[model samples]
Structure formats: C-alpha cells, structure tokens
Target: MSNIHVYSEIGKLKKVLLHRPGNEIDGVIPQTMPRHLFDDIPWKKGAQREHDCFADILRKEGAEVVYIEDLFRKSFSQKGSREGFIKKFLDKHGIFNPHLREQLEAYLLCLSPEEMADKIMSGIKKSDLGPKKQEDFSRFFPEEEYEHYYTEPLANLYYTRDPGASIGRGMSFHCMEKLGRNLETVVWQHIFEHHPDFAKDAPMWLSNESHFGIEGGDIAVFSKDVIGIGCGLRTRPEAIEQLAGNILPQDTFKKILVFTIPKDRKFMHLDTVLTMIDHDKFTIHPGIEATLNVFEISLGGSGELVYKDQTDKVEKVLTKALNLDSVQVLRCADGSFIDSEREQWNDGTNTLAIAPGTVVTYSRNEVTNELLRRSGIKVLEMPCGELSRGRGGPRCMSMPLVREDI
Candidate 1:
C-alpha cells in the first residue's frame, strides 16, 4: 500500500497537509470579502497562533504535519519550475498580451522560489504588472471587468481541504466552483506533480484541467469500497458522478453515497454539516438531521452505473453503508434548537477525527463541544476566535494525506 491511503474518515491520521494563514489574509480587501469566501476577515497573527496550536496537537498525536507554503517552495526549486509556473499563472488570469505577460514574468521571476510562491499567494498589485502596452488585448467587457490584479490572491487557500482530496492511493485535484479558489488548486497540481514526498505516492485520480467541480471538504471515505460525498454549494452532483466514473472501475472503491445538501453557504460543504466520528457514529447539525437527500451509486456490469434512491434519514443510510445494525447520529448543540442553529453556523459540527472517537473542534463552540464530550467522545478544543471568521472549523483546515486504514 502507498503512504496516501485514506479508506475511512476516522482512520489513524499519519500525515496531513495544512496551510498557515499567510500574506493572503493581508491582501483581502473589504470589497473582496465575498469573493474571498469569508464572511469576516481573520486576524492573521491570531489565526496563525491558533493554526500553530492545531498543527502542534496533530504532531503531538504522532501525525506528521506537512504545510502548503513549504510544499510550493520545494516544488518550485526544480530547474525551470518557477519560470513555467509564472507563465501559467499569468496566462490563467487572462494576461494574454505578450508584453504584459513578459513584464509579469520578469517581476515574479525576480523573487527566489520561496518569495515567488509567497508573492503569488499574497497577490501582485496592478501597478506591479507594469503599464499595459497599447496593443494589450482582453476578452473582459469594458465596464464590467478589470481589476488591480491580473489574478487576485487566493485568500481561501488556507482552507486546504477545498482544493483536492485523498482517496485511498489516489488524489482528486478539484476544479473549484469559485474563481477565487481556482488558482489554489493550480498550486496543488504543481506540488502533486513535482514535490518529491507526494509525487510518487499520490496518484492523480482526477484533475481540474478537465472535469467537474469537487472539493475535498465534501468528500469522505466510508471504507475502501464505500465513500460518501456531498453535493453541496461548492461541489456539483455532476462532479461526484464523474468522480464515480473514475473510481468505480477499480477494485478499491465500488460504492459512492451522494448527499445532496442545501446550496446555501451556511451549509457550504459536507464537513460543515456532518462529520464521521467513529465506526458507527456521526456528528451532524440539527438543521440537516431530517432533510438531507441521499443517493446510492455503484458500478454495474459492462461499464455502466446503477443508482438507487436512499433513505432521507442519514442515520439509516449510514448504518447500511458501514454494515452496522444501527448508527448513532449525535446532534450538535445537544438537541437545543436555537443553540444548535447558532453553533452549526459557527462550525460546531465540523470536527476533524484524527482517530476513532477522537476529534479536534473549535473551543468557542462550547455547547456543541460539551455535548460531544458527554457522548463519550474525546473532543480536543483549539482556539478559533480569528480562524472561525473564515467559516470553517478544524476539519476544513487540514487534509489527510497519509492514514492507516482501520
């Protein structure tokens, strides 16, 4: 087996990828908060502190923690990696004019690999691209478009799980639905294709170069052969079905459970509304307790897929998926209507299970975290005063890269 296996959500995490809030936060303008996918801005320094504590806890638990910035730095250290990345990065943002692209490349290439990576994440100013030539051409409509940057900083890159996911021995590099997040996956593609530690072990099962949108936060492995994906705001149902196309032929994964949740940003991705905590236990927001749409998909004979409508009650479907007689669905905020709503909005249910029955959650979600503890689960709390502003909890911040199959 490769070092990238993640056959189940509650597997023992051996290694994970995280991004510490960096200059991207500094580049966030009030005008761009919505574009950045942030309801409110995070205090970068405090968010960093909290992120450090999060990584420290994982390291203390024996999980090797890899970081985004470090990976990009290493990946760009190859002979012509920086120059190649600059061309693609500029071209992606619609800087098609030859002279403009050359100036942008020159500006970016002036930095070392480390600074080049950071600069791209932090964003380059419009003035930094140099004055546009008279012959510059663009498809952007005159009044409706153009900005200070050919490409804006990917502020949401810190939420590492949204770009891609690890499925058993393979990884799905997502095509993010939001333009603000698209380049984030580009950075991941480069690292996945070039980074020494990940290149060999993590095979690309899907890439955004040509595919529908699927975010890592919406994907969870139920077992080697069974997996669950959220058809949420950021993930399209077509994407999940297409992903099924990529995996169903292999013996490693045979079934996919697609949970179609509301398109509202509050329940943005699956992890925000539900998370697996144990072999037969889950933490879910009361808001989605009774109304989630479920569908079962599996490979049929002769390269066809079979589909079936599933029970609306997630607990019933999960029991069957995990082969358990019954599964426990614990409500966030302990069944209180108002508190549950508030905590769910605060990502109280978005817990990260590092191992069975153990999870990392935000300390501010006191009501929900307390309830998780009373249910015989070990809830490790991390400060999130600033981090929560991004509308994600622990699970949204980390992506498991190596896990021991339970």
Candidate 2:
C-alpha cells in the first residue's frame, strides 16, 4: 500500500494538474454542445488564453501547474506503456475492425504525446482528407461514411475535478459513467501508471469499474478524516459503497458522510450546493443546509452500516462529524422562490477554492457572488457567459491535485 494523504481542502499543495481546453471544442457542433453538456462551443484559441490565465494564477501562487498533454506524451513514449494502453482501450470498447484498428494504432503511434492525448480526447477529423480518397474511402466501406469516424470526443475533459478525488496516500481517478467520456479515464490511468513525474509519487485508486460508476464531482474532502459524498444522477449508491469499502480500512480517513440532494439536473453534485470557504465556514444553498437528510456511515468489523437511529440536517451532521462549531451558510439571492430556481439552474453556488478565504466563481451569479464577497471572501471572476452554457461553473473547470494550506 502507498502512503495516502487525507485531504482537508486546506492542505498545502506542492503541485496541481490541469487540462486546458483543446481542439476538442471544434468537434462539438454548435447545435449539440449544450445537450452534450456544454453551453457555447468555445473558440479554441481564446479558451486556451483564458485557461493560461488560470494557470498563471496558480503559478504565481507558487503551485506547480502540470499540463495533461505533457504527461500523456511521456506515457506514450514508453514502449510497454503505450502498447498496454492501446490494447486496453481497444479491448474494452470491442473495436475489432482489423484494418481500421490498425490504421488508428499507427496514427496514434505517430502522434506526439500531446497530439495523441488531444486525439484521444477530442477525436480526429474525417473531413480533413483529400477528395478522391474520401470518395474511395466511402465506397470501400459502404456502411461506414468516412475513413475514420470521430470517437465521441471527451468534451468534458477540461473538468478534471470530476475524476480526481482525494483518498488515502493519493487520489482516486474515477471512471466516468458516460461511455463518450471513458477515454478521459483511460488517459488518466496511463498518466498515473507511466508518467515519470506522477507515477512514482502519486498513487491512484480506481472507483469506476464495469459494475460501479463514480464521478469526482460527487465526492468532497471536507476534512482530512472526513469525506462528503453526493448521491444523485451521475454517481450510484453502489459506487458510494465501493468507495467506503476501499477507503475505510485506511488509517487516514475516519468517517464517510453521505448527503442526498434532490436528484435534479442542476444539482448534479455536492459542490453544486456546498463548497468550503475559510476554515469552519462553508457557502451553501439554504435548502441543502436546512432540509437535506445526511447520514453517517461507519465501517464495522465486517463491512459498513448506516446509523439508522440517527439522522440530522446536513449542517448539524457535518458539524458534529467533522468536529466544527458552526458552518457559516450564505443563501443565494431569492432563496424564497423564482430567483433561487433560476440561480441554482445556472450553477450559481458552484465555486472552487484557490486558498482559504479566496475563490473563483462565475460573474453572472452577481447576487450570489456579492453575498460571498460581502462575507469577506475574495471572489475572482471567470468569463462564464460562454462557460456556463455547458451547465457547470468554475468548480467544474478545475481539478485541484494539491492545495497548499489545508
């Protein structure tokens, strides 16, 4: 077993990993971007610039900003690693079209690590081929329209936080539920297993498998010894069980807290309702703090059992389990009716902490951000009009591997 570190959201981070938006945006047709869970198809170059700014912020703060593509390239350069990765991908997807598979393998091998990672994440363009070849290719396989079809790209790859969740000694790279998004997990596994910078130092556990599905967005590391898991559309109850089973035996974590939010499209994960700000302070929607039912599950000699006799409001439960006094709750504007509905639907409550008392959020959530700012929390704004179209906010875009002040 590797040394797994308990994450309390305030741990001093030495390094952080991020995936910047790539040409994958080009693969998303403007009409379908939202349904695929994106708002507007971002201009690749502009998105890159915006992402650079975010990276610069971290770099300026003295955290190492590791790029996903660089790690992917390093993994692909290793012979045994590349072959193992390609084999696993093809076998899992059941792609047996010999000639097509061979062609893709060759193309993949020819690409630099960055290009290969981009290709795997975004997909290769079919229309880029010459006209005569296109016509001949169409005829060669009547059923298949082009020489190669775009693998449904991992359009959500930029949201690294969804797959990287903290567990013992290291973090778990969650397997995605959506088949189209599976490639991102595959890439993560490759990087964790083969990337020189990460392979030796970073330990990873798999939470998503054929039978269980989990997403990182649904899990929150509230304290070094406590984890808050959100159960809803993206993560199954079984997945939660699997996580508890694997993590409980580890000495670092002492309790697993379960918060069941209404399974609405907007409340996709816990962060959608709750986020940690300063120590002992949290920003949450009133409904979640006051009404949601929270259960504390402890590991028993055999397995695990929920304390059926005791159930409490999320705030009280969290406060007791994590050993805190009071959690400062900030209500989004219009906490009564129409405005709350509109704001929550727009991901107004989802914010990511850069450091204690400092965070990033969507500027569009003016009332909510203002409330947070008035509370003495520094609110850094991202150009979210285009970003929000995808149904997630700042929290969704970032995947923090290390935070420096836990």
Candidate 3:
C-alpha cells in the first residue's frame, strides 16, 4: 500500500514514473548538445511518439504509468505551493537582478499550476521576458555573457530514472553529476514533499542536498535484502558510502554491492552496461567485463559499517549476494565485441523488466533483443530511432514506483 515499493528489478511492476518528451527536447541545438548531455538533437514529434509507445507497453502489462509533469502539477495544487516552488526555481536558476527576479516570478505566478510546471521544465528564454535594452543587463553581465540565451532547460528530464530512484517503500533523490541535470531532482523533491498522495507517507532514503554526485541510473535494487550501486562517471564512492550508512542499518537491506566501472561517457551508468533481467540472469555489455571491480558494504552486529573488497567475477558476486546456486550472464550481441560496442552505445543492455523474464528494450538493438529471446526472456521492443538520440533506453527512461515482491 506504500507509494514507493520497488524490491527487485524483475518484480511484477505495479506503477512506474515517466516523463514525455516536451519542448525541452527541442531546446537541444548543436551548439548546446554537449552541455545538455545529448549527442544529437531529437525530432520532437518523433521522440514523443516513441515515448508514448514505451508507456503503452507498460500499460499493456498492467502497470500504471504516471508522468513527472502531472505529479509536479499536483504537488502545487495547494494554495501557496506554486509560489514557494517558483521562488525556489528562481533562486537556483534565475537571474541575479532583483528586477528580473520579480518579473520572472510575476510571470510564472500568473499562469495556472499546470502551465507553470510545463514552463519551468521547458525553460525560459530572455526573449520570453520581452525585449530588454542592453543597458538593463549591462550592469549584471559582461558583454560575453550575453551569448547565453536562456535558463538551462531540463533536456535530459525524459530519462526520468536519473533524477531519483524508488527503493523498498522509499526513494533516493539524487544530486545529478552535471549542472543541466541536477535541477531535475528538485522537481522530484517538490513532488515527494508536497504531492498529497506521495507526500503523506513515502520515506526518503537519500536527499538531493548531498554534495557528492549520485544518480538513479547508477542504483539498482536486486532483491529485498540486496542492492547494487555503480560508482562511475555519474556516482561517487562517498555518496555510495553515505547511502549505505543510511540504508543498511535501518532497512531490510543486508548488503550493498558496489561496482566500480570505467568512468567513460560510453559507460555512463551501471544500467547502461548491466541490468538484472531475471532472478538468476543478467544482461551485460561485454565491454565492461574487463574493467569492472566489485565491493560489498553492510552493517556489522553492532550497527557499525563493514566493508569487503570482492575478488570473485561479477557473476560470482551476484550468485553469492542473491544466494543463487548459479547465475547467467547474458552478453549483449551474444559476445560479438564489435556489434556489442555499437549496440551498447544505443543502450542495448538497458532493459526494463516488468516481471521476471519479461523486459522492454529499444527495437534498434536487434542482436541484443534476439539474444534475450533465445535465452527464454520475453523481449518487448519499442521504436527508438528518436528516443535513442538521447543515449538511453527503456530502463533509463522509467522509474518503477511499485512492484510486487518477487
């Protein structure tokens, strides 16, 4: 009955959170692609169509899909929530000038809560504020600063998994590694703090206020008592230690498996290279097998922190952690290194499991999809010609809110 109840990756999903691609996707032009964390600009309509298909698959499987924007709007339904949200938004992202801050606040407050929520996510351009004489900003910014056109857009928001993750009856709000994505968690913070349905009971495992970087994509719950966190480009060891300290002693969790992966954009997060598809089976990109290092964290008998450096292979690590007799490591593209590299770049290993042996992935990764099917997994594929432009697949775009314990 809890709002957040994800216990395992392959559980029967009951509810999930997603964000439809909006004008935010359109804001990614060539000049801003790197800053926005996109490799290419996605066609807005095509991206929306793809995202819709992704949602449709979840619905067909009996999972209730909720949009981040809708949840955010509901969070502001109270009398003064909108005003408070707008102030927080401006304080972190608005211009420093008092006059401009007042103008932006007035503009945002005039809109309905739903419209304001969309506007904030879509971003505010200087042009939206009407023509300001150069003199107006001359005192606040140098001549070179004028080249920056607008407030940073939440372009990466559609990959809703990075902002926060749903653990067992609780959620871990992240401090995203990049400036463009960090604000995304603020939206989640607002929803979890003010939305009546969620705010009433859901517990928070980690707060976004942490100085160290951590992302939802890097955290995966394997079972009720086990969690695997990737310490790589987007997640820091300090944050992982902090999360383990907070979660291990109090929750059902007994051990936190920490994977130190290659810190490269190509291997951005653990989910991008590895994900549990079934109780004893995992889908992994072969590219990372050579560089991956594993560790374990748990609480001692006296509630003191305990750490162990793992020496077994990744498969062995999982087998012992989950108490399984054996584990299957399904290589992406069935071990075709060249093909695996290409497909992994397109998120071949990022599969979202709605139930044991059932997953949703990008249709473009034909080799990987076929491999999953050959391994007795039900693979549902979604069109991702546009969605893949963002370099994420099904799992990266979804955050399971509730799942029946496996």
| Top candidate (TM-score) | 3
Better of 2 and 3 by lDDT: 3
Lowest lDDT block of 10, candidate 1: 138-147
Ranked by TM-score, top first: 3, 1, 2
* Best-to-worst lDDT order: 3, 1, 2
- Alpha carbon lDDT at 28, candidate 2: 70
How good is model 2 by TM-score? 0.87
Q: Which wins on lDDT, candidate 1 or candidate 3?
A: 3
lDDT of 1 at 95: 64
- lDDT values, one for every candidate: 0.84, 0.68, 0.88
Clash totals, every prediction: 0, 16, 0
Candidate 3: misplaced stretches above 4 Å? 132-149
Tell me which residue pairs clash in candidate 3. none
Candidate 1 residue pairs that clash: none
Candidate 2 residue spans exceeding 4 A from truth = 1-6, 12-14, 30-35, 92-94, 127-148, 207-210, 287-291, 301-310, 334-336
* lDDT, residue 135, candidate 1: 67
Model 3: lDDT of residue 77? 74
